[model samples]
Target: VNLRSFEQAQLVGSPFIATNEKNMGGLPDRTDDPTEEIIDDLVSGRLPGVLILDPIKAGVVAAETAIKVHPIRKGKSGVPDEQGCIDMAYNCNGCGNCQRNCPNDLDLVEGVRLAKEGDFSVLSDLFDYCLGCARCEVDCMKEVSPLTLLMHAGRERIRNETFNVRVGRGPIQDTEIRNVGAPIVLGEIPGIVAIIGCASYGKEIQELYKMAEEFLIRNYIVVVSGCAAMDIGLVKDDEGKTLYDRYPGDFDRGGLVNVGSCVANPHITGAACKVANIFARRPLRGNFEEIADYILNRVGAVGVAWGAMSQKAASIAAGANGLGIPAVVGPHAAEYRRMFIGRSDDDDTWKVFNARDGTPDQLVGPAPEHLLTTAESIEQAICLVAKLAIRPADNSKGRMIKLSHWIDLERKYKGIDLPNDLEKYIRVEADIPINMKEEVHEYLKQKNWQPRDIVDPTLLKRLCRT
Candidate 1:
């Protein structure tokens, strides 16, 4: 089941039906609070296996379970002091520092001030988007915790009322990508770029559309979920139509696929799994190890959570990395305390199973040095994402496409030369683009680049827990 705005829910369509009848009739103009009605459905077991996308609703369910909450470790910048929002609300000078520094652009100073006057609704949406990054705490001169204030407001708000939404088609089927011949016959289209995560970063939605547009124009498949899809939905073209309204939904080059809400996230990863099972003809039904190894070695896919902010988000990242698909998180993810970083210089770190004998062996470092790493900005992420999409299994065409973009981005943003070992991905002279052939050849010559061939290049892990 889904719970978001009516329009947001309808975009999901089939296989997922809205639980609330009011969704079809449009929201009712009732005096009754919506949250109360939802609680009734959940408690009475009317809605089974409901997926909570809205953080507020998730919090409400947690509260009802009487779970002790620790949003962040104690004594972080944004916890309540001896006196909390009730006492410190008056101290907000309205300098707007909190709002300015907020990645999501929430009007936190105003929300806190209003809460003090007995109104908590002002910040309701903001709390829904908050990642608890505590960037606001660093900006607040008053030492007021916007995180604390938002939580108090959320607790109070949850007790009162909530909004209604719809449940649309759940997630994309892996069979779909198979029909399109993905991973095999992948063409010049390099890989799958899944841009996902929270909207709390306050990034202008247009930036996301442009990002998708860039990759789409370049023939890469772009997929979105949750607020990232919503961000794209918010942008309009010269015709004043959103990408969701304008673009065709397909898992192919220049096609934008919106895989519904956050719960549908697995479908993004599922695409990679399909590449192994369907296209590569690997076993998948229950053999998790073989499938993950195939994906890690063969499929060229990467996930970017540019605004990950919650524990659930962390789990999603962990799960993806565990599957051997590396992910890139936004800088704020540093607060999450865990990022899988691989050092290319440390050959010992590049351990993979040579499926030839199902024995662990040291392989050359993969294109992306890390399974998961944080990017300081979207520009860095765009570059990192392109680089991450390179796989050892890439043909000369795929390698050329990936390397060109990675080289251009590195020059454009970081203004650095390509690392000597980067030539390891260049299997042959034809793999290098004509424009950069000499430069790449020169680099390769210095590194004594040797052509290493894998008779059967499937990666395996010593241990894989389904």
Candidate 2:
């Protein structure tokens, strides 16, 4: 079921139901005594095994009844806890910092502020303009981490607003899976690499597209999903081709596929499965299962997911890993660290994970050392993953490429240049000139100290004694 439909079912006082088998019935009417009828049917052995309902509605009712039953004591005020107030304050302050530092001038501050004030009318509006580049957090010294906060808050708002909403049924679109060109088929092309994640207040996911472009130049298929896809305008390619184009490269300069929204991450997994299937059928000495096992155990056909806060990415990684595919998450390390050690004001710890064995192998460090914004680290990790994908004994097989060479190539090919609009955001710090020699000489003179037949030309020149 889609999110909208699930939410609507909750709002209309209807019990949200899930069943293993179909053909129960359509939605129940509002006037019908659903609870009584459901109970009667259950008692008579006519109902199914399980039934579910929206817990939020029950909680709301319970809270309301409790408030009505127990009035606030004499001097006590009726309000949420101190932690809730702190969270509200933190969100407001962090969002304010994000807006101030945002290069694109997004109203993140206003959106979060509204959320704090229990106003969500503009929540979706705020999300629509977020580039998800994560630059806002990058520039903030307050350690705001607006991206995750926004996603959580947005999801909550969506839950509240869309509850009891209904979605009309529609036929599922049949999507085709095809290689871009003869190069892809002739073993001349590198396999696809899809970078999938969410776009919150930060723009960190934008780096995925940059990485994709680099991978594309090396003849690798590149796919992006979720809010990350939206940032780069992946919903539609430059040539107006559907996301599932026969030739992704031809449709969009080269090799960029936006699978869909967050839930559509299964598309990436399916694509990888298709590639594995094709590889398995090519009389390559191994079947699909064997190849999958090999890739899972030996070759690193790994999925790298950035921004781990979203359950969607975690779910996708689990599915892929279950299929014997290696997977890595960029943000889980920080989460683990935060879970273990409390957060510090100046700390910027980011984490990365390897979920190949269903056990997380985490890499945690300062953000500058581990996270995005530092291209060198990301490049190295990608190179390492690629190197792991190659079979050691196969001399004829092409080896995985190194990230250093890729980085060198990128540096050589694309010179340092900023976008025109971003020029205003650049600030040049002033340098103070200091004459060390003159200062030293002045100090020496003041102390009535003189060198014994020794003179420094630089010092003498600075002291006007040359």
Candidate 3:
């Protein structure tokens, strides 16, 4: 019941694991017990940060947690040495620890008090002001994160009064899937890149937009959701056009699909499943392994969570990997203490089960090379996405298109030096770009490159030739 540990899972699971019993049966039916109450509040929002909320909400430690220099609330005109109150003389009961710990400095305790009295309209402002930083949890004796009080309040208000919530738009439509199916299958487009998660503070907003536009110009299908969906639209050109304003919101080359809040993430990944269903007539019901296999072998999809400060975004990135989609997170992602980076140098690390004979085959290639990895900068992120988008199922033309972007981004960002080990992926002369064909040939000749036969890939032998 420390309640602090729940912070990590808050981002992705809170939606399905909600508070009010009626509102999805309340993940645990959040009772008034201090621990459940704190979890109640925690479930209301999803933001990860360094300053964990004050868990010692019921202890004296709260008094010394913050700067201890703010006006007391109306409940207590606190005197110096007053029990459970700061030294400042004021009418508040709390030590103002929640206020100071809040990144936006909102009155979290007051919100809770208001909810108890059934006047939760005060919490409306918290939605915008609260950046989801769970900093308020420092050392609560009762072990509760004051950060989640907002959620508990929201749930209480809703349990008393009913309101209509809008249904989120989910999944890629059949037509849009059909449209991008050919481009993705044929490799006419590099890959479908989904940029999701919150915007990191102080990071240049335009940097994300530029990365997306880079893929857009290269004709990579870009899908954005959650706060990242909005960040890419904050910057504009001389024409006052943001990426959203300039590009069509479709699932095709040069299209920018903003699929709404984090709840709509299924649409982005759903598009991948839809590809197998719509294009190849693969059944969509309860077929995860085969569908995942199809995506790994053929679908050139990559997820770039450049600012996934929350565990929900981390979960989304993990979910992407579950589907064989390579995920790239920002440099700060290393703090999560988990990653799935492949060793490009170790040949054994690149083995794939060639279902053709239920036998393992060594791929002298980097097909979705690393499942998950950190990117230090935007340039590296761009190059990495393109690099991971490569798969064995890519026809000559498909690999051709993907490699062009990978090589171009490497040269553009890292400077005129071509990407290292470019020979590992090029199976035949046709896989090289038309303009750079000779240069690639020269490079391949020096490395003694030989053409490789494209194999039918399947991790499960059930689908292989008997």
Candidate 4:
């Protein structure tokens, strides 16, 4: 049978026979005997099953669609429910593609081969080498994303193999943050800011951490998870130890807590609830509601989920906003509009704010021009929230202020530096290698600008003038 017919039959779960005849002619010429070579190949075990016309075509089929008919060996007690070989093949092929496409040039293919051979020890190193960017998926013919799949799978295995995986109903162990000197002191603080999202390659996340540190300095409890959390070392450094080691006593009052993996982001919401619960006690309840009212009304506790496609972080932010918490997202303006409005066009719950000046007034207000990095976004969000919290008047007014407004007001209101230490960590074009630095400098110089500076020249003007 032809390859297409064979594929169709396989799809329909049908059994069909092939004959050594051209167009089903009873009398066959030697040249017309198409099945003879295939039959001989199959009988000699040179072919695994039926021989297709071409090896590349056959390999593509096998790689893309081969199913595990049966196990090569039985388990010690019984047959394992999971098909190990099939899993190995699928994962190995994906890993090969990942290695080929990796910009860092890591041996993802060999890593997966070793993993398939049952080497768990190398898994961590293999995964760590991944930039956690999904470039491999773009290059793959099968549309498999290696970084995400491997990270998730590796995390599951590590979680299962290391600690008896337990799901705590409430907050993760407070000691987790305590060890880092960034403990969650619930009622001790007025509010908490959660920085949630995926970590992609580039300096965006590093910038976010600097921002988080600034919030910590301001005594706002900060929670982070997922790749955003990982980017900030929440997974490995449970206690904010690394952070404290770098900036001792920096996080003494406010804390930086790493909840867990991406799945643990909702824990940030729970922590917020805990904060609400703490303030809801008798005398504090009125104050709490008042504070909640202020936060709900003026102060913003925003979540930034740029680079990640999953709208989970953004959704959580909206939920918090519904409960009187404010949120800021870094997704495209349209998506932000969708999340904000939901089904109702009349709902202007989230006062549109942006760091950029020319941002449409209907969707986003201006964000900080310098707060381009994910870390910066987080810090900026926290700073904005902190500013509103500090000002009772601003909170009561129900005004949505740009992050830059608070950044400008930082020194005046709180006597704190507006840019703070976060600016040091923000990677800019000037921070690139010396050779590359010249290129960036030249580019900006030609445009009469500096590195990291926004040049908003109109395309028509530039084109027409040139």
lDDT of each: 0.66, 0.40, 0.69, 0.42
lDDT tens digits, residue span 1-466, model 2: 2433334333332333433124223533222334444444433434322232444433443344334324322233222243443364354454366777664576666665665665544545665446455656565565544554454445544345311111111211222334332223222343446566653433454445445555666655566666555544433246653333423533122456666666776666555454444543423244445444433322224456664345566666656665545454554423433211213222233222322222222222111111111112345445533332322111112221322223234344443221111111111111001222344335445545433211111101122221
Error of 3 at 255 (Å): 0.8
Q: lDDT score of model 4?
A: 0.42
The residue ranges of model 2 lying beyond 4 angstroms of the native Cα positions read 1-187, 234-253, 282-291, 294-300, 332-397, 400-466
- Tens digits of per-residue lDDT for model 3, 49-80: 11223335423222331212122222221111
Candidates sorted on lDDT, descending:
3, 1, 4, 2
Q: For candidate 4, lDDT tens digit of each residue in 1-466? A: 2434443343333222323333232222222234445344333434434434344544444443323221311222111112442254354554366676776666666655555555544545656455555566567665444454455336654456332111223364433334321122211243456666665533455555665666666556566666665565432235535443433222234666666676776665544444334432213344444334423322234455644435566565556654455455553323444433222222232123222243322221121111122222444444455433321112211112222334444554456643332221112443332423444345445545432332221111211222
lDDT of 1 by residue, 281-389 (tens): 8777888887777777667778887665566666787898877788888776788899888777766666555545665563645655678998887778877888888
For model 3, the local distance difference test gives 0.69
Candidate 1: lDDT over CA atoms? Answer: 0.66
Task: List residue ranges in candidate 4 displaced over 4 A.
Answer: 1-191, 234-241, 244-252, 282-302, 306-309, 331-385, 388-466
Give the Cα RMSD of candidate 1: 11.8
Q: Which residue pairs collide in model 1, if any?
A: 12-168, 12-169, 13-168, 13-169, 35-162, 103-201, 103-202, 104-200, 104-201, 104-202
Report the number of clashing residue pairs per model.
10, 15, 27, 19
- Candidate 3 segments exceeding 4 Å error: 1-169, 202-204, 351-364
